[model samples]
Target: MPKKTRRSVDGSRLMQEDEAMTTGGAPGSPGGLEEIFGSLDSLREEIEQMRRPTGTQDSPARTCQDLKLCHPELPDGQCQPQGTQKY
Candidate 1:
């Protein structure tokens, strides 16, 4: 006969859930967030380091629409930003 593990619904279970939520992620997965922000902050710093001199600066300061891609609410594949070209 095999033994079946029992699940608790009270204090111990809540503590377990809390502990799980507090960590960055599971032990081995690279999807953990510390890596993500580190990469993105690095990219933003790279962008800021570029030279955009006066009179010759033809770039939009940052189209608000482009900035939206940085938000969690924006959908993926849309950031390639087709149809946004301005004449």
Candidate 2:
């Protein structure tokens, strides 16, 4: 069996790491972690809004009706009642 040589583990540090170490908010700086948390909270709110049901009118049955209206040649079984239609 050939002896396997381990490669050097040390790699060049990224520029972003150096910047992150140097540049930071002063004591008076308004926006930093608080701003990030606020943005995250807003994002969570938006995600919750998206996760919630919009309305019953825009449901799968309505979608099936729209699809059926667009393509009448498609079998009724492909839409609803007799068969399952997924959004």
Best by lDDT: 2
Candidate 1 colliding pairs: none
Q: In model 2, which residue pairs have backbone atoms overlapping below 3 Å?
A: none
Give a tens-digit lDDT track for model 1, residues 33-52.
Answer: 67777899988875753433
1-87: candidate 2 lDDT, tens digit per residue: 556456633345445444554455323453455677789999998665444433233433335555555456655554335465633
C-alpha lDDT of candidate 1 relative to the true structure: 0.47
RMSD to the native, candidate 2?
14.2
Deviation from native of the Cα of residue 68 in model 1, angstroms: 30
lDDT of the candidates, in the order given: 0.47, 0.51
Candidate 1 lands at a TM-score of 0.30
